[model samples]
Every structure is written in C-alpha cells, then in structure tokens.
Target: MPGSGVSINALPKVSLHDHLDGGLRPATIIELAEAIDLDLPADTENDLADWFTAQATSGSLVDYLKTFDLTVAVMQTHDSLARVAREFVEDLALDGVIYGEIRWAPEQHLTAGLSLDQAVDAVQEGIEAGIDRVAQAGLVIKIGQVITAMRHADRSLEVAELAVRHRDLGVVGFDIAGAEQGFPAADHTEAFDFLARNLFPVTVHAGEADGLDSIRGALFDGRALRLGHGVRLAEDIEIGREDQDNTYVTLGPLAQWVRDREIPLELSPSSNLQTGAIAAWGDDMLDHPFDLLYQLGFRVTVNTDNRLMSGTSLSRELALLTDAFGYDLDDLEALQLNAASSAFLPLEEREELADAIVDGFANA
Candidate 1:
C-alpha cells in the first residue's frame, strides 16, 4: 500500500502557461450561456467538454484557437470573469498547484462594456477570494495575473501600460498572446520598450507557432524572461549519429543562447500536441523535444496550457511526461524548481517559492 496509497494529487506543482480564458469550467460555461441566452455547441456539460477537446485537436494552431470563441463569448461580463477567475484558482488548487500564473488578453474581454482596468480588477477580486477560501480550508496557494495583449491586435502599448499600472494590485507580469506567427514581438516595440523602461518583467508567446526568429524578437525586442510554449526552439538543434550509442548533438547560436540564458520553456505536452506545435517531430507525446531540451540543460517547465480544451490538469500533464520520459519524483521536483525560479516575482519571493517546492517534494 505504500506506493499505491500515495496521492499524486498531494504533490506540489507550479503552473506558468495556463490561460484564464481557456480554463473555464464546463458547468459555468453552461450557466453563463443560459443567463446570456447564448446557444452552445453542446447542451450538456460532458458533451461540451468533449466538443472542446475534439475541436482543439485540429492539429493546427489557428484551427485549435477557434475553440476560444465559445469560451470568450461567455466570459464578457464582469461577474462571469470574476467567477471564472475564482474557479480557475480553486481548480488549480484541487490539482495540487501551489502557485500559478494565469494569463489572458484583456482586450478580448472588453466586449461587454467593461474597461480593461475593470476586467483586471474583476479577475483580481476572484483570485483574492479564491486564495482566502483556500487558506480558510487550511491549504496554501498563491496566484498572480499575467496581463496579456493580443499580438494580432494593435493595442499592445496600451495593454503593457495597463499591466504596469496594476503590477502591485495583482498583475505580476506582461505577455503577448494570440496569433504568434506573423505578429512578431517586434511589432510591439513601443510596448516592449515601455515595459523595459518601467522595469517590468515579460514572458512572450514565442517559438510556438514560429521558429527561432520569433524567439529572437521576444528576447531582443520584448526582453522576455520566459517563453510561452517555446517548444519549437528544438528546431535550432542539430543531431548527428555515427552509431546508436554515439549520437552527437549540437546547438545553434539561438538554441545555445536560450539554453545558456536559462530561459524557462513552458512546455505543455498535451496542448502542444493538440495545437500541432510538435508536428515537425511527430504526432506522439514521446516525440516532444522536452526531454532533449531538458537533457541539454534548458529550464524546462511543465504546464496545462488550456485545461478545458486540452482536457488536462497539471498533474495529468506531469503524469504523461513521466510515463513518456520515465521521470521520477526527482524530475518532477526539478521541473517545479525551474518554474519557481523563473516566475516573475521578486527575488526574495522566488526564493521562497523554490524553498516551498524543495520542502514539499522532500516530504512527498
């Protein structure tokens, strides 16, 4: 009973790449839809969940992203946003996430007449309520908001200012999400420069839909401390094999810079597959470059990019990685440690998070 009785749910974890808009509960979506008199793709919760999963498996990032229309449709109101944020944190806590950074584009949620500040405030209120509720239950969890701008939109400079304005309230960092291919980080030069001038931290959505050039823009233009779904950085790696046991791997300048700088890669195994980020490698989880990047000493962290769409929890993602890569608890701990260190919190706060991960994993 020793190992069988052990609960993977009790393990400490960190979530860095989760999207707030993409993690809506199926039940909540149904209720919100009913209140707003909106027709859903499916009437029942289970069917809706399955529909989301299927739609997300389109094997193309743009196609996969279409599933967000229904979700974002329901999340236009301040009340709905608050409720979703609160439930998102509770769900992560239930999944054994001790710390999480939730990212979402504010401009997308303003269709309901709520200002950007109001939207962020509503989410913050929900997050604080969730934190207090979890603390009352004798469980500790911390969450921060990453204000995201839509890369395809032209409001990044305004969004970046909004993030910096709310830094002390609930926003911990800034990000640019949405279509990542053509809307390079360079397009948001003013925004990035403002963030840099204000000493704000950033994590860019690079190396997911595009390749190393996108990543280069994120670093040189956006000054990103982390890369959201930076899985495509593997393309910069060159492998040679004289024999099965003598495989030689070499990193190009871009890959070497990323690895040497220790830029944390928020690798979402299931989401990456669902969105076809790893299609170049293959169509299986085993084909993901996560192991290769980790082996080469890149700061690789596991995440649930879209819990509802991907039908995954952080624990489930970790389990999948463990199954595919033969990772023990030590490897799990290492991933959490990397996330803790890479978080956009203050130096002391990050250190405290690292200590918590170390202590929790030790006891586990």
Candidate 2:
C-alpha cells in the first residue's frame, strides 16, 4: 500500500461546492472583525473557531447560517474580501487541491459601498495573489469564482448578468444558494433563462434542505449543470432487496434522469451531517448516501461546503468518507475525476484536468 497510502491530504483533488465566505481562516476573521468593530461570540481565535463549529453542529439551519453573518460582515470591504479570498486559495493549495471553484454572492457584499463589480475585482485580486503564493511555494493550483445569487432574494437576474460580465476575468459559473426549503429554483427562472440564453453554466443548491421536487426544478428551471449537496437525491432511490453480496435497487424518474444524465452531485459529507441535510437518513456519516450514489454509478464528487463551519478541509472530508465507507486511494481519485469532468470550465480545459488527475493518481 506504499503508493496507495490513505493519507488523503496528499492526493490531488478538485473542489466544486466550496463557499468563499464560509472558508475564512479564524485568525483572519478575528483581525477583520476587530478592525471593523464587529462584536463576536468568542474572544480568541481558537474560541471563535470552536464557536463556529458548535453553532454549525447545532443541527438547525438558522444556527448553521448564523456563522456566515459574522464572516460576511467583516468581508464587506475590498481589502478584507481580497485577503479572505487570498487565504482561501492558499489553504486549498496547502491541502493539495489542484482546482477549485469559490462561490459567493456579490449582492451580500455591497454593504461596504463597493459596487458589485468592485467586490468581484477585489476577490479576483485576492485569488490571483493566493494563486501566486501557492505557485511560489512550488505547488500548482487553479481557482475560479462562481458568482452566486441568493435563492430567497429577487436580485438573481442582476447577479447572473454580473457573472457573465466577469467570465473572462475569474468568474466561471452561476449559482443560487441559501435557504433552499421554502425557495425553489423556479423562483429565479428569469435569471436561469438569461444564463441559458447567454450560455452560462449553472449549479443549483438543491436536494439538500429540500427533496426531489427541488432537484427537478434545478434541472428544468435553472438548467443546472450540477447539484449542490444533492445527497437528498438518495430519497428517490428505492432499495428493492439485499443479500450477502448483491443488493437490488431502483431509481425513481428524477433519480434516473439525474443518473442517466450524469449530473455531478457535489455532496459535502460533513456539511450535510452538520446542517441536518441528511437527518432523514441518520445523524452519522455511515448513514450518508454518498456510497450509495457512488455504488449506483452517479457522478459523485466529494466536497467541503464550508471549511470553517465544518472544521474540515477537502482532505479531512475525504478522510471522513474513507473511514465511513472504507474508501481507498482509487475511490478518492474517482471522485476527483468526477469533479474535474463536471467543472464549468471549457471542455478542453476539463480534459486537461482529467489528464492531470490521471497523472496524479497514477503515482498513487
């Protein structure tokens, strides 16, 4: 097992569902918060980090999202946004992520008087700075921005246009995130239609806080190329019979379409458990549908939805899955390939990613 050792951090990987506001370093958050006179729940960096974890683990959507208000409050200015984005990439590269898509909503950042374009430029500046730092340290990594529109908010059309406006700079895809239960993807049909007409790639936050109907809306209304935390798609899978080695299963129409279409599921195992997205299944990682989706040939990709809240990295998430499902080096590589292939990048660039994954995993 020399080449295939289970040190998951050393494996080259791709992250698709990571949030920019959710992955800020604790120390940096304290500094930014202090500068802006923002009151925090904890005094020291470690305590603040622990507070984040505790709140996220409270299993309530309200509690889990409370952590973001703090993260986003400090991120109102261009400098803080740049610094946070810079560190986000640095951290991902240190964890051996070769490619990542960092998503955040610009409408939420305009409180500091920065225009939407200015906020994006600030993040781009930080990302480039972070990429340079990683490169100087002798590791190669690439990152792209996914401009997000809040699901409950009505500014998606504006955000979608912003995403398209910056496609050449750093923005890659469009996404609709936040409060997925009462809000459906169809509410933003105009934005999705605009993106579709303009040929912009989209990934909808579906099948996480909601169920199968939301996923159908994501595909039909949002024209989503991927599902964010789509672990709930497992709700549509019916177990027929099971024996010692063979288990028969059936996919519902929605599940069948998702599987046959091979739409990548950006399943964040830890975040799913933390947010109670998998509560119906159970409270443990063993109860996660990640292995079931993988066994059924779904394009399953592993991710860390919010590194800070979950107290995890991509490496740590993979390690958790490995522990829960007994996954090995090959399994990790397969997930990376799934993510790379499903990236919003151009087909040629995606193929290059595939080749890089092949080369990296070959060493394993």
Candidate 3:
C-alpha cells in the first residue's frame, strides 16, 4: 500500500494519538452491551461497525464524538475496560504497531463504582496481558496509557495527578481532549503548572476542531510537547504563487515556531476528513495539508485517531497518505521515525524504538 510493491501493514509503526474508547471492536461492544443489558444501535457486529463508521463521517466533530457515548457506556466496568484495552493492544499489534500510546479519560469510567486509580490499574493489567499475548506469539509490542482529561471538565488537575501517580505503572503522559473550541487550554492552568513542575509530558488536542488560537493555547498555556491533530497548523502557512518553476510560500510566526521546534503533528488523515477538520481547504484527501506540511519540513506523524470510528488503521492511514502524496518506503519510515522520536518515553527507550524501526524498514 506504501507503493514499491511493499505492504504498508508489514512495516513497524508507532501510534501516538489513538483514543482507547474510540477503537473498541464491534463484537466486543456487542457482547459487553448484551452483558450489561444495554441497548445498541445495531444487532450484529458488522451492522454495529457500519453504524459507527456512518455516524462518524458526518463532517462534524461534535456529531462524530457522539458515537463514543455507546462505546464508553459499555466500558463502565473494570472487566469491560480491561477487555477493551486488551483488544486495543491486540489490534495494534496485528496492525504492526510496535509502540502505541492509548489515551482515554478515566473520569468517564467511574459510573460503575471504580475509582480513578482502579481504572488506571485495570487498563495497566489489560495492557500487560496484551503484551504477554503478543510475546507468546513471538512478536513484540509495547503499550502506554495517555491519561486524558476532558477539556470541558474541571478535573484536569486530578487527572494530571492520576497520570503522574501511574507514570511508573503504565501511564506515559497526560493529554487534554474533547471539545477544543470553547474550552481553551488556559482553563487548565493549574493542572498544566503542576505537570510542568513535575516535568510531565503533554499532548494537546488542537488545530482539529478550532484554529490557531487553540494551537497557541495548547502550546503556551498547556505546555504541550505535541499537538493532537495539528493539521490546522497549515492555516499559518501563506501560499503566494505557484508555477512550473516553483511555488512561493511564507510561514507565519506560529507555523515557523512549530516547524523550527520540530513538535510532532499527530495527523490523522481519515479522522480529519470525517470530522470536517480539512474542510477549510476541501473535502477530499488531496485537500489535506499533510503533504504541504511534510514538504515544508514539519514533523508530521500519521495516526488513526479512532480506528473503529474511521474504519482505519495506522497502516491504512499511511497508505491513504501514500496514495494522496505519492510517498514511498522512505516516506513511510520517516513517518514512523517521527512518531517514535515524539513518543513520551525515556531517551534510551525512544532510541531503541527508532533502531527497531530502522531495522524493520531495512528488512522490508
């Protein structure tokens, strides 16, 4: 799918912006919903999967997010969350993801009488079990939790504390997700301050639902090391003229800063299209700013924001980009390298992951 007669799914990849609640298997959701005696949009697994993809592609972020209500509802129990998370890892491993950060809001799962700590522990247990399953199959996969706090909610400080508390267990970083337009990162200043004081890594959901102001808030206010769906950062780039000879381009200060600093842009091709994130330019893959950002030397990393919602995988996202941008093996490897370097891991661990990517690509 990455061209050159090579299968993109066979390459070692890294996933940094996947949401746990958004990637559940349709069969699992059906079984869990039945176990809980909850209603569902569809009866069969195939019908349920089709329902989710259809609802998510409505070209509205709010509408797309509404699909999570069902997934989260069924995942309210400890066993359910663990099962969902375990399946999350198993899916990523099958997609050839060597390292992945699964982000989810623990606060959303407390309705079943589980504490914040317990929620994190259950996810960690599931992740460990998933890792063991992969190893037993003679494959390697590592998973981490990016404990997310709802941006519209006021428990960011508590969520930050939860992330720090579980840092040694399974949590690798902190994130602010959900409703990015009205809820500025400034609203969580106290949480950001605490995280900064503790040297915790942060990735903010900006440039997807909103514009430059949100991205600025994510950086200046939240101290984000990475931008989740930072595709709208393309707004900061000014295109002057195009000719057979060359195209004149100018970068706004914000774009220049992000490019200079090499902050990874978690670009989800399908999710961005489904949620109308790239509607400013057009409604097709060709209109996506991913290629422009990459050509201009921005640290752009491909992602599948929600595999089930978008009906995509990391390999599928890369293949879509390859088709849209005419990328080759080198381009695919570069994307993985960007994701590996941008992961919230220790320097040594990140280097090891990069080496693995290089080896995998070489063998490919």
Residues 131-210, candidate 2, lDDT per residue (tens digit)?
99999999999999999999999999999999999999999999999989899999998999999999999999999888
Which sections of candidate 1 miss by over 4 Å? 1-5
TM-score for each model = 0.98, 0.97, 0.98
How accurate locally, in lDDT, is each candidate? Answer: 0.92, 0.92, 0.94
Q: What's the count of clashing pairs in each model shown?
A: 0, 0, 0
lDDT winner = 3
Name the TM-score of candidate 3.
Answer: 0.98
Model 1: which ten-residue window has the lowest total lDDT? 1-10
Per-residue lDDT of 331 in model 2: 82
User: Which structure is stronger by lDDT: 2 or 3?
Assistant: 3
lDDT of 1 by residue, 1-364 (tens): 1144555678888899999989999999999999999999898999999999999998888998999999999988889999999999999999989999999998999897999999999999999989988888888899999999999989999999999999999999999988888899999999999999999999999888888899999999899999999999999999999897898999999999999989899899998998889999998999999999999999999999999999999989988888898888788889999999998888899899999989887787
Question: Which candidate has the top score in TM-score?
Answer: 3
